[model samples]
Target: MTRSVPQRRTLAAAAALAVACTAGAALSTAPAPPASAASPASPAPSASAAAGTASGYATENGGTTGGEGGATVRAGTGTQIHQALCSRAGTDTPLTIEVEGTVNHGNTSKVSGDSCDTAEDKIELKRISNVTIIGVGGGAVFDQVGIHIRESRNIIIRNVTVQNVRKSGSPTSNGGDAIGMEKDVSNVWVDHTTLRASGGEDEGYDGLFDLKNNTRYVTLSYSVLRDSGRGGLVGSSESDRSNGYLTYHHNLYRNIDSRTPLLRGGEAHMYNNHYVDVHESGINSRAGARAKVDSNYFQDSRNVLGTFYTNEAGYWEVSGNVYDNLTWSTPGDKTNPAGPDPESTTSVDIPYGYQLDDARCVPDIVSRTAGAGTGLGESDGRC
Candidate 1:
């Protein structure tokens, strides 16, 4: 039935209870014990939801945050965010838009594509540079709106949750993507954010965070991506070799099906992340793509890391990765082996200096710090 992660979790608990009841009614009636009672409760979200959001999270990239020296602007709701970006869409000046509470896209259409079009379809960050868009306070959520980036550079988006950005439910709707970028976008840092959806294409959901058409120098860190069919990508197509040099670190990717990201002809450093309950695949490093897969934890996943689902091959230098209960099959010499395996291929030297969290500590560190609204903030796993 393709139950979602939350749904499956609830169902599994119920099933366990039913089993317990069958064994002994008194056992099922007893108050349930707290799961992992010995583990400490995670600290409060201490990262300021204001202008510092980017700086707080982007420190993972050696302080190369694009919005490091930008002005700050506070905003709430979708219209304000859209208008703020549109106002500076064609400018080169820096601006920081601080978002609070929730924003809605109004389920518009024709934000991107051509012809059968409407003006209110997309909230495009177009032709802008040196910007920081951050979430502040309790929670910041962009609901049911595709946030598009185009011809933009030097941007930092942190501590925001983009979810259910589907459109008015039509064949031509160009919304649905939680976040997307294309056309010469560069030097973007997306951190401590949550990009999610309930279902796949049938529900009008697209990529959580997709990069395309020469976008480069990007980093996605300390984030949570889940419950969508396509997680994300590096290049837009088979010919997109120009867009590369990305880093994905300390993120929690759960309940996704594929593209965990489908890297195409780009160099990506994917390390210290956690992939859980990925149904079909994860990290499809394909189309001449080179990936440095290091020290990630993958649990209850199938084909969690590999060169797969296409004829074109990809290269990976994997080391210190922990594959717990990961399922795989040999597809004609294209074997996806989860480690504790020695690196068999040439290692791709990452340009920046960073620490590799012990594979055993990934789940603890990531669970404590990754994603928005974590009490301890994005404080852990910084460079």
Candidate 2:
């Protein structure tokens, strides 16, 4: 892929995003065990049955192995999902829940148990570990609801769609975040999922994917986050700076206003992603945060990278990115634009090895392989 003209404002060096694809062979839908049979014998691990693998930062901090070597269950409603978790013998008991239908407020309710801390109006995975929730069959949609993860670890959510969750105006879930994690979360891999909202906070929608309160070791890959005011955030506020160690790649962010994630404090690697129609700002790295932005494709966006809305600036290392039809805003009290021309302000050393797809192929590659469907597909690891 032909790279844009390199522009340097500080140190003169070229960088390319080294991002790895996080996908396993697609899983096939198996017949569901009855709800009462919560721990059905696990199917033999195969390309079609094994839980998806973890990559990126999820491969760190002891790694994320959600529900591996555990029993598998099928859930068609929200209640059953909660029941499946509650049925586990303990918080760390491995279990996989394959969902196959709509999971919403009407069909979901809290099920109390020693193993789970749940609530109504949302699908909660709280105070737990070693769990996987994957969509199969016709697929799983959490419409007008959200998936909330709190104080949890070693969790994987794949091939699911969460949309239109509201924090106000009647029904609300996960504080209007389609997928939210907070309070000591660790080692989570969310892949091949779709998270979206209709409008901004004024329209009752919040972030599509948000993390806060010391959450760490998370990766979001091969997914789509679109049509919302806020894509997501790492820390809740400037003071909430404990969260860190994130990786986002092979994803699509389209028609969003800002915060392709607003990082507060931590290190993040963003690569091989596609951004389109980012109306306001994108990738707001602020409050002493540091980001390695590489080999990404940004088109028809404005202020696609930099610290924003704060005087406490974040830093970024930029390389091998394509910017087409994007506009830059003037630097102001709380507005800092990274381009019309971008350069590295800092340097980061990634602990993991990754592949770099040329920025030229990113838009086409991410479009075909991202989101809840397409059978959890992946690129060929080639340009």
Candidate 3:
């Protein structure tokens, strides 16, 4: 994004933020970005912008091919999927598990008050490594169920629709997410998937994709996160800040309240995504979290960036983003930028090679390329 204004005081403000965070004045930082950070339109990427391809950071982290060269196994039942996971030869052997039809977990698991025997309710991808769970063709639905990944590595979930994970209004049931990961999980790529809900938190729904408790090296590309109270969380708790090294790009986030992915104490790279009708908040980086926000399209959203509600200081470096018909509020700290915003940002070291769509073309490109069942056809998700 080209800037017409001069950037002189941006680094000074960042230094001040570093000092404030170190001095412990910040309890939890979640501030909104200043109005000056974005223009009505953004500049498109140059001839050489890199987009994160399937072979990119989102998948195959450090040459870890999850089920890349394995035998294909198709499962028609939810129980069969679980059985396949438990029957894998080893943690490093690759296996491609294709799921078909509507796999319902309600038969095995039921929610009681605030607790759910998720042991019976979820397709728990536990104690497994180097696995890729993909939908077979156009229709594989996980209804009222969750995909829980724990203590695993080198996993990929693609071309699936996870929706309406109802557990009788219990946020604690089934880990409260469509796709949830925790407990030392690493190297996950969720691509071309749909994680959604018809109702909000008042109706008992939770996050779309959540990673917590030391989960790292994750990327979510060409996905849809919408119609829910929470989008996702990087670190689950305030003290659980060691998790996060996540990437979100070329995705669509619509009709949401907050945390279009709440990041707490970790580094996140968010770029080339479309955010629409965000009612309350978005991209809440808090508790010493750092976000590199670049080349996004925000339409009819409010407080789409920065820290809010918490006093813990969050840091953001923003560039090449477009804000059209966006709404903002001057509330508290960590949500609002003080002076001239950074036209550029501190470099985040990512180890993959890819292409980047120009910021100005994000709205049109993302609408066509994001979500499940679209884009470059390969899991690559090129715009």
lDDT winner: 2
Candidate 3: tens digits of C-alpha lDDT, residues 1-383: 21222222235433542431111111124332222322322222211111223434445346435677676788766777766665666556677787767878544342222111125777777766878777765456888778999888888887788998864564234766899999998888888788998877778787888889988888888788989888888887788898877889878899989888788888888877899888777888788888878777777777788676678867788876666555556545445421123233245655554455545556655666566555223212222
lDDT for position 84 in model 1: 57
Give the clashing pairs for model 1. Answer: 44-375, 45-375, 49-136, 111-121, 111-122, 165-176
Q: Local error of candidate 3 at 305, Å? A: 0.6
lDDT of 2 by residue, 1-383 (tens): 11223223222212332343322222224222122212222332222543677878999999998999999999999999999999999999999999988998899998999888888899999999999999887888999989999999999998899989998876877588999999999999999899998899999999999999989999999999999999999998899999999999999999999999999999999988999999888999999999999888888788899888899999999987887677777776787778767889899888876766667668767877789865777665433
TM-score of each candidate structure, all chains considered together: 0.78, 0.88, 0.78
Evaluated at residue 34, the lDDT of candidate 1 is 32
Q: Top model by TM-score, which number?
A: 2
Query: How do these models rank on lDDT, best leading?
Result: 2, 1, 3
- In candidate 1, which residue ranges exceed 4 Å CA deviation? 1-64, 86-90, 107-119, 167-175, 333-343, 379-383
**Least well predicted 10-residue stretch by lDDT in candidate 2:** 32-41
Q: Which pairs clash in the backbone of model 2? A: 309-334
Whole-model lDDT values for every prediction: 0.68, 0.84, 0.68
